[model samples]
Target: MPFAVYVLGLAVFAQGTSEFMLSGLVSSIAADLGVPLSAAGLLTSAFAVGMVIGAPLMALFSRTWPRRRALLFFLAVFVAVHIAGALTPGYGVLLATRFVGAIANAGFWAVALTAAVAMVPDRLKGRATAVVVGGVTIACVVGVPAGAVLGERWGWRAAFWAVAAVSLPAFLAILRSVPGGPRPEAVPAPVSVRDELRVLTGPRLRPTLLTMALVQGATFCAFSYLEPLLTRATGLGAARVPAALALFGAGAFLGVTAAGRYAERWPTAFVTYGMAALALGWSALALTAARPLAVLALIPLLGMLAFGTGTALITRVLALAPGAPTLAGAFSTSAFNLGAAVGPWAGGLALDAGLGHRAPVWVSAVLMASALAVAGVRRADGTVSGVRVT
Candidate 1:
């Protein structure tokens, strides 16, 4: 792999930390902002809404810009927004900052994936993409947990400040490392909006997009409430929750690594089985929430299965939309955020309805099952390309 690919991963790590750290800080944020817990949860949904809107729109807006330039521009916006988030005096302002920051996050991912894929060989595409996505896993492992600790000690604003501080170096790294040239041959040509829309909306790609939305919806439904679930259902103290979150991150890292090895060769089976495993994991989590040890054991597996499918699902979308890599990548990002938005919102509704912390787990299981069924139907219809396994 090119050194530049890992540099892209670093950028992802910076952005991902900001994206996911909110999960652990929701309670603190709720208390600080004087909002309901469910309202605090909407911070996640707000960020997702930004991503859903920004991914394709920014990708298209920057389609003509050099990849390196686009990346730097977006990273700068990301850093600026983090600073805004750190400094915001009101909950509404904080929410608005999250939305803008996510727009930057979405744009960064859309271009970064294009750039990362361009740096690798055909056979290495899956692994290269995994390496970039691995940054998110690492953030989950290190950044999110550390943010939790920071929020616990210094207030959630400290976590935002930290994310802003870290992003500067990532910006410098991209400036120093990534090339500032025309799109590589491996990258698809910039397509017209109509053409991109056609590719994105084609019959073969629709199911993959739907599956992406459903799977991520399932994952975040449970994940958005993981901290509360741990404390409430599993009897974990605040201090212990970060460690459990780290374990989940470790599982996600492992899942992405494993998926890189097989995603390209067995995209359909990988996605199908991965979603099934996620469903089973969430179902079991719902059943065992009262058992602290069992809950601890299952969290990592849940993270693993969710992210494992994520890597494959991205690869599958790229395959399905070979003519529009940026748009496809953007569309895929949108789908994931669509799920991100829906999951937490749905979970909040469940909580509002007096469903316990365990309710999100059940919601996750149903979503995963729905996603798996979609993948199964797609497979049966032979809509997925028959790429020969190496």
Candidate 2:
């Protein structure tokens, strides 16, 4: 793996910290901004909405730009928005800043994933992707907890300031490590809007996109409410939630590392088995939420299985649309964020309708099961390219 891959990962780490850190800061934000908890929570939804829209839009706008240049631009925007978020006067401005920040965040992932794969051999593409995506898992482990602590000790604004500070180094690292501009030989010929749309809408790619959405939706359904579930359903103290989240992040890191080893060799089976494992984990959580030990054990297991499929799923999309790697990557990002937006909304509805904290667990299981079915059927039919799908 090139050192550049890790540099890209550092960029991801900075952006991901901003993205996931909100989970820990929502309460403090609500209280400080004099808004209801539900209103503060919309910041997350706003970010997701930005990602869902921004991935492809930014990719389209930056289609002619060199990967490294695009990355730098996106990171600059991301850092700017975080600074804006830190200094915002009220909840509305902060929410807007988050939305804008996520646009940059989505653009960064779209460019970074394509750049990482470009730097590696075909066989190591999955591993390259794993290296980059590992940043998100690390953010869950370190960034969110630290943000929570910062928010508790100081204020949510302090957490935003910290992210802004961290992003400056990541931007400098990328500026130094990444190539300055696009290689003339490496750039693809100009693609039309119709051609790009066709690539994304093709039959070979749709199943993979749907599977990505389902798996992500399923994972977030339970994951978005994990802290409350642990505290309310499992009787864990609020103080212990960070440790539990760290455990989940550790499992995710391990899962992604393990998946990288097999994803290229067995893309279909890798993702299918991961989905099955996720379904089982969620179901077990639903059944064992009252058991503190079981809840503790299951949370990490869920995180592991949920993220384990990342490499394979992205690889599958790249394979399906070999002609348009950046667009495909952006579309994959969009699908994942679509799920990210939808899952929590659905979970919140279930909770509001009188379903207990355990509702998300069951909701997640059903969604994962649905994803498993999609992958299983596609595998059986040999629809997707590259993999035997057997």
TM-scores of all predicted structures: 0.92, 0.95
- Candidate 2's C-alpha runs over 4 A off are 183-188, 380-390
TM-score of candidate 1 versus the correct structure, residues matched by position: 0.92
Best by TM-score: 2
RMSD of each: 2.8, 2.1
Misplaced by over 4 Å in model 1 are 26-40, 184-189, 383-390
| Candidate 1 lDDT over residue span 1-390, tens digit each | 888889888888978888888877999999988999989978887888899999999998888888899999999998898898888778998899899999989998988887887777889989988998899999989888788789989999999999989888888888988898866533465566787788889767888899999988988888878889989888999788878878888999998998888889887678778887888889999999989899999988878888989988887787677778668879988998899889877887899899888998899998888887876676666634663321
Give the per-residue lDDT digits (tens) of candidate 2, residues 235-276. 999889888888889988988887777888877678877888
Candidate with the greatest lDDT versus the true structure: 1
Clash pairs (backbone) in predicted model 1: none
